[model samples]
Target: MSSPWFGSQRSQSMTEFALVAPILLLMLFGIIDFGRLLYIYGTLVEAANEGARVSIKASSPLPSNSDVENAAKNGAQSLYLANPCPNGPLPPTSGAGAQNPPGDQGWIFITEPNPPTTVETSPTYDAPGGQSPASATGSCSAINPFQSGTYPLQVTVRYNYLFFTPLLEQLAPSIILQAYATDYTEY
Candidate 1:
């Protein structure tokens, strides 16, 4: 003459936990992995911004793209708990004759608007009100304003992120992170 459900209640609870434990563990790991990914993205963005700021300030008398890239790398290293490249700086140049002075290469192209030029061969057709022949219908010329003017700086950082956690690595391949920043020269 005992209670009908008393003896079975504990077994029911145990069975429930056994059924749900794996799902709960999976969800926890998934959350951790997502958080790690977000952290990596934030680090990359900050690094790019720092590099762009350094480049725009003209920290180097003649700042090159390589200089900007290095700045970004330094920023990333500062943020990363475990750096991907442990040895030294990566080579900035593209191919043969790539290695030179630290800042020999990696110059970024700066384009400028060209000046206007008068067309010589066009006929001077008068407007309805006869408005000085429309300034001779000049054509625009191409000019390199950056030759003497301060130009905007852009920095790009490319990183291959390898996952060390076996759980995440098996699920997802290596990640690629690209960061970029652009700003006008300080001066």
Candidate 2:
């Protein structure tokens, strides 16, 4: 005399769980990945700013491309600059402290824009433009920074980030993060 609904509740509940579990897991992972992305981006931007700040100084010993590059890399090194892919070593940092990358350094670049030309050469003597010498390119270098006049110094950084969530892999291999900063030289 048992009804057809003797134990249907248990089976129905299991089916519902099976369907909802994946969705919930995906949502959790997405949130984690997005937060990681923002943190990494902020770090990169700060690094670039630090590099530009150092390069804009017009001192006896000017900064070089490598010097700027080092600054940028060092600033962001405390974080996972590259993909920590599964099985990777310990994270760049465990807590809220800074540490160097467990693996190789991420790709960093610093460019030097051509400074303004004070002298003009042509069939006749003429000024290139009314722009002052300080009107140099925004790029900066330890070798030569903006001198004597107020000019803009720019720093750029790029990073390849790996997602810990496998779901990201299906969408794309790796995400690209970039940072740039521009500061005026001390006149």
TM-score of each: 0.52, 0.61
Best by TM-score: 2
Clashing pairs in model 1, backbone N/Cα/C closer than 3 A = none
Candidate 2 pairs with clashing backbones: 62-142, 63-142, 63-143, 64-142
Candidate 1 per-residue C-alpha lDDT over 126-169 given as tens digits, one digit per residue, 9 for 90 to 100: 11111122222223112111222355544444455555556777
Model 2 residue 126 CA deviation (Å) reads: 25
Candidate 1 has its poorest 10 consecutive residues by lDDT at 124-133
Clashes of each: 0, 4
Candidate 1 deviant stretches above 4 angstroms:
1-7, 59-70, 77-148, 163-167
lDDT of 1 at 2: 50
Q: lDDT: which candidate is best?
A: 2
Model 1 whole-model lDDT (C-alpha atoms): 0.44
Instruction: Write one digit per residue (lDDT tens) for candidate 2, span 1-187.
Output: 5478576677879999999999999999989988988988899988878877765666555554555666766778685443221111112222443233322234444333322212211111010112122222222111222345666655656566777789876786666666767766554
C-alpha positional error of residue 113 in candidate 1 after TM-score superposition, expressed in Å: 17
